[model samples]
Target: MKFGYLSISINFARQIPMLNPTTGEIALFHALLDLKNIDMNFPSTTGKKKTWADGFDPTSATLQLYSGLSANGIVKAREKLKALGFIDFKSRGRRKSTIYKLLDLGSDKSAFNSSDNSVDISSDISGDNSSDNSSDNSVTLIKTKQDKTNTNNTSEKSQATPHEQKKKFSADSVEYRLAMYLFGKIKQNNPQHKDLTESQEQKWADHIRLMIERDNRTPQQIKNMIDWSQADSFWRQNILSTAKLRKQYDTMAPKANSEWQTQQPRKRVYE
Candidate 1:
């Protein structure tokens, strides 16, 4: 699908780490951000009720097309962003488009503020506020995302406190067990693996819960896939996180099944 140019604020670009969004969340947020820009340029004629004054109501299909996320991924990302206070929404009724508003990241700099909201490719963003810093404005947020990825291993838990590790959940719960199972396999591969913080554990459990309740994968199947992937020479390193496993589940499933078939000894022909 063709996409028009996107204008992202330089200040907002720098605050991404503070947002700490997942890949899907970031993608959906950018799509919405772009839509907000478009709306500011040519707003809806339906009258700006306070309920949706600064909001943009895009169809789910439009979001999927623009964000490159599946319908389910968009739903999950929307919920996550709402919880994070980066965005808010109002339901318009069943089968109708939902109105979504991007909240100010923090401080006085509202992303879509009426006074400063402009779509000039040169002056707004990706160009320059002044002549000399044109190249600096040219630095894409993609590079910043890449830099965050590279540094994740060192800084992933630096933001979490030691007390957060003391947060508890039901040990007998299937979600927690599945999360711990994945964490155990990770620790087997690397003995020094750190324990999950509260949020990490909750996120991992939620992914596993969705695998069961949403994806229709049984607990046994998930366990089998976990074992198979962790034993494989290549996937062992790559499938270190529950989110990664969930993202790659379909691709890994067939290979895992084939490997399982090969590893099983053939039945004897005769007694």
Candidate 2:
């Protein structure tokens, strides 16, 4: 069959042996058939890569099909092909290129004939006991399918919760949590230093944000007030220090208190 510019052929048999370009092995016919969807590309003598997109390019397709083989497998496959007189390859020099040519298999056509014989055998077997053979095959297929379904369900159930999953799936999210924890620790240690100037507070916030973004939350051991504020202690001190500083600086500044006191009057006894 031809789809677009790619051609596909299938040869079925009880034990069909052929060279597997992908794995460079002698495998059963069914195994090759299973790789029907793989895309292949080949290089031409003109040193240009060919593809199905440009009409039929079997040479490029064949080379691409063999590209997946391991180095050792490729060597073995080439040797086997040489022995069978099916293909020959030559290399000119260390840095030079190689060339390949296909040879006829002659009268050893039994390899291709096996595919036809297998079809006859299948027909004979099916005709002799059609109902019983079909029932057996159906039961086996059902069991295999059920086993796969159960395994997938078990896997899904073992998955983690969203919060836990997020932490596991993303290193950045985990770092964010650690940064929050470090800020909490910082705030806890600097209860009295809650009145940090605006610039100082902004600097610490920016640092925490950057650490979270970079996913670098390695803990440091410095105990200085500023260091503690940058560590995980910032969270704890945020609320307490904000309230205290507001009371001290906004409500009870000496000048503000004096003004409030002056505005108050003393009661006179004239009645």
Candidate 3:
């Protein structure tokens, strides 16, 4: 991606802390903003012309270079940014880079939705609905125990509910075997790593299930990815969780293919 200057509004910048972004999240957000700018200014040289509407589709390495964050940091920070409504990701495909859409910070839209209600960013930050009445659409940054609890609860419920809904998988199932295989690899990598609870194990199994059923990955492909991710130096540390493995599958696939191909034994014939 080409370099482009960011022009963040002062009002927008002020509300960032209210969203309680981590240092990595903040840096990644700015890096995305830069990408957005680049997309708007530079017309496509070969492919379809990209606009802000089309969104940016930079690779993980590109993001790491721009944001000065590790691969793991980019993933975690991207998830946080989505939770805070700072950004959204649109999947291109299993192999293509995902398109990132930045949300309008000054809008009255809620950062996230709950089962019962939409959690407004302003109310969540200030711990009061009155902040929404302000003529200027800016979130108030106030630190309160209740506010912290509300944010944490919302984040937890959103992430946990999906896994909790997953049906049980038996030991003989491929999902279960893959989950166990991953856990075993993790233990081998770090002896001090804590063992998974029953619920945690089930959750990991569910992620593998999604990989096969939803992502259209074959059992063999998923196994290969698990093996490659676990054995690779950088991915070993970052892909400790099956969830992370699923999230990064597309990005890691090409590299894994190259690695796998190089390891194949070459046949020789006497001439």
Question: Per-prediction TM-score, please?
Answer: 0.36, 0.21, 0.39
The order of the candidates by TM-score, greatest first, is: 3, 1, 2
lDDT by residue for model 3 (1-271), tens:
1111111222234445356566688779868865665455344666663433345688888889989999889878888888876777876776888778666554544422212222222222112343343433221211111233455432332133554456888754557666776776676556457878988888888887766555655554565576578769999999988789877876787676665556542411000
TM-score of 3: 0.39
Note the Cα lDDT for every prediction shown: 0.57, 0.29, 0.58
Residue pairs in clash, model 3: none
The residue ranges of model 3 lying beyond 4 angstroms of the native Cα positions read 1-166, 265-271
Q: Which ten residues in a row have the lowest lDDT in candidate 1?
A: 137-146
Candidate 1: C-alpha lDDT? 0.57
Q: In candidate 2, residue 111 scores what lDDT?
A: 30
Each candidate's clash count: 0, 17, 0
lDDT of 2 by residue, 34-81 (tens): 222122212346665332222221232344353455445555765765
> Candidate 1: which pairs clash?
none
Poorly placed runs, candidate 1 (over 4 Å): 1-8, 46-53, 107-271
lDDT over C-alpha atoms for residue 10 of model 3: 24
